[model samples]
Target: MTSTYDQLVEIVTKLHNPPADLIRPDVTFAQLDVDSLTLVEISLRIEGDLGIRIEDNELEEDLTLAATTQLIDAKLAQ
Candidate 1:
């Protein structure tokens, strides 16, 4: 089974089409070259695909790839 971390990475890759190496744990949204609108779209995609609700405020500007995976994992655990 795909881990939540890997799944989130895949979602980001699909959304940004970034190079594979750029899609890892330490990466930030800034590195993805995503605009504000894309971030909102990605958030919605994550919520829809993972069946979790992510409020806009929870997705702070400083959020990282690893943190996002953890967020989703926490929501799944709930």
Candidate 2:
């Protein structure tokens, strides 16, 4: 199955300036130097990639990759 983690990793790889070869689920956005603007871009990219729309308020700044993946998973499940 195309799990949320997989999707998140794909997006991070595509969007990251330096781009990570592998994205750990536990990694934090701050570690990547992803600011609010980047996160907003990521949100848009996710919707475009997954064909699902997420509210802006739904995303938290402290959202770990793992947590974001979980949130996506839940949204996809719904």
Candidate 3:
């Protein structure tokens, strides 16, 4: 199975098509130019694809991909 971080990268790639290097773990969604609406879409995709629901408020643009992966992993562990 793909790791949570990899899965998130795939979802973001499908949604935004950003440069590969910009999708690093340290990068925030804001750095990728992801706005509020897109963040909601990304959150929905993550929930659908990963089977873990994350609130919109929890997915701030400042949150890094690594942090998002951790959040998902924590939820999955629950």
Count of clashes, each model: 0, 0, 0
Question: On residues 1-78, what C-alpha lDDT tens digit does candidate 1 reach at each position?
Answer: 999988888788788788876777888888778777778878898988999988887775468989988998999999
Cα lDDT, all candidates: 0.83, 0.78, 0.93
> Which model scores highest in TM-score?
3
In the range 1-78, model 3's lDDT, one tens digit per residue, is 999999999999999899887879999999999889889999999889889899988999999999999999999999
- On the 0 to 100 scale, the lDDT of residue 31 in model 3 is 96
List the candidate 3 regions with Cα displacement exceeding 4 Å. none
lDDT of 1: 0.83
Per-residue alpha-carbon lDDT of candidate 2 for residues 1-78, written as tens digits (9 for 90 to 100)? 677787777787778763564357777888777878778888999899987777888766678889998788788889
Colliding residue pairs in candidate 2: none
Worst 10 residues of 3 by lDDT: 15-24
Model 1: weakest 10-residue lDDT segment is 54-63
TM-score of each: 0.89, 0.82, 0.96
User: Rank by TM-score, descending?
Assistant: 3, 1, 2
lDDT of 1 at 50: 93
* Segments of candidate 1 deviating more than 4 angstroms: none
